[model samples]
Target: MDTDRAAAVDPIDVEVGFLTPALRSDLLERWNEPQRRYHNETHLRAVLRAVDALEADGEAFDATEVRLAAWLHAAVFDPTESENNERSAVFCERVLDPSAPVEEVARLVRLMGGHRVEVGDLNGAVLSDADLAVLGSDPETYDTYAADVRHEFAHVPGERFVAGRIVALEGLLERKSVYLTRAGRDMWEKQAHANLNRELGLLRAGAAG
Candidate 1:
């Protein structure tokens, strides 16, 4: 309920600032698609807010490129499609302002699909950390996010969902550090780990039951 439930994407949605009105509308419509739950406009706003938080924390980055990446990271979301990021990057590259450093944003959005920012790429670090901020939300918020994500993938059978979700969660846990930026790590590392472990535990219990 973060946005008006039936809010239409105005061609000038400004959510996609700098893009032509038509491209802005298209991007917003993608975020507003009925199929989405967690990856909706609300999630888009949250990630943008995280970008702002990063700036407030004094994190150095190519601000324009990072924010541009944030806006388009989930532009072509398809829970069932592994190539959504690549697709999203293509769409972004096609529509982004010619002077906006397309290659950098494309790289950030592509790597962001897995939250795997390249080491020392501060722009990527900011975008990746912003994308993962939800992982460190409080239990109530985290639970809500988890449920919304499940709903988004409701097409998957329950067992498959559990299995796929476990592999994904464990993959994140296996990472040496889930958040790359120092601020991100300082703020989210421990809590994010706890949240992932807790969810994995619940999924296992459900599988056992």
Candidate 2:
């Protein structure tokens, strides 16, 4: 039997309840953890809203799965830990949908690491693009986000963080397009590039100083 193909028939069973009250409370607790400055409910909601907007205006497949991915994508965020995505994906897989393509859910969650998706994978494209929509945010919003991110990594020294941040920004700049969905590409690609370049320049100058 083609299990993967059969599971694809129902991408997201949104109507089927999954997030219990206990689960919701646990999720909120993690988001509200003291160590988190940026990967909190606010950022999660922003990504959720971005997904909503994308669904309303663009092509998004397996939307329920994408929405669930939004909830759990940053669930294990830790500035000091490198396995946040992997850890989060594992947890999400266990809870997302057992009968469905749960591993597929994990795959999408893992993609949050680089925000990269196969060209034809709309589920991945939508989720990844929505997660990165912040990059295309207006200057003021983007600045606030940057500040929040630095706060998240508060344990790190300013110089070290800035140097690392510049490296990350430069990597983003090198991407052909950070936002992969059609809506993302049309609405945010140019703005995202401009934002990335501007930040990289500022961070580079700061590092030099």
State which candidate has the highest lDDT.
1
When summed lDDT is taken over every stretch of 10 residues in candidate 2, the lowest stretch is 7-16
Clash list (residue pairs), candidate 1: none
* lDDT (Cα, tens digit) per residue for candidate 2, span 22-81: 666677788788888888878877787677667767474886677777777878878899
TM-score of 2: 0.86
Candidate 1 C-alpha error for residue 108, in Å? 1.1
Worst 10 residues of 1 by lDDT: 5-14
Q: What are the runs in model 1 whose C-alpha is more than 4 Å off?
A: 1-17, 20-22
Q: Against the true structure, what is every candidate's RMSD?
A: 5.1, 7.2
Q: Residue-wise lDDT of candidate 1 within 1-209, one digit each (tens)?
A: 22332233331233443656676668779999888999998898778777776776679998878877887888998888779889999988988888778998899889977776667889988898999999988888899999999999898999999999999999999988888888888888899999999999999999999
Candidate 1: C-alpha lDDT: 0.83
> How big is the positional error of residue 82 in model 2, measured in Å on the Cα after superposition?
0.7
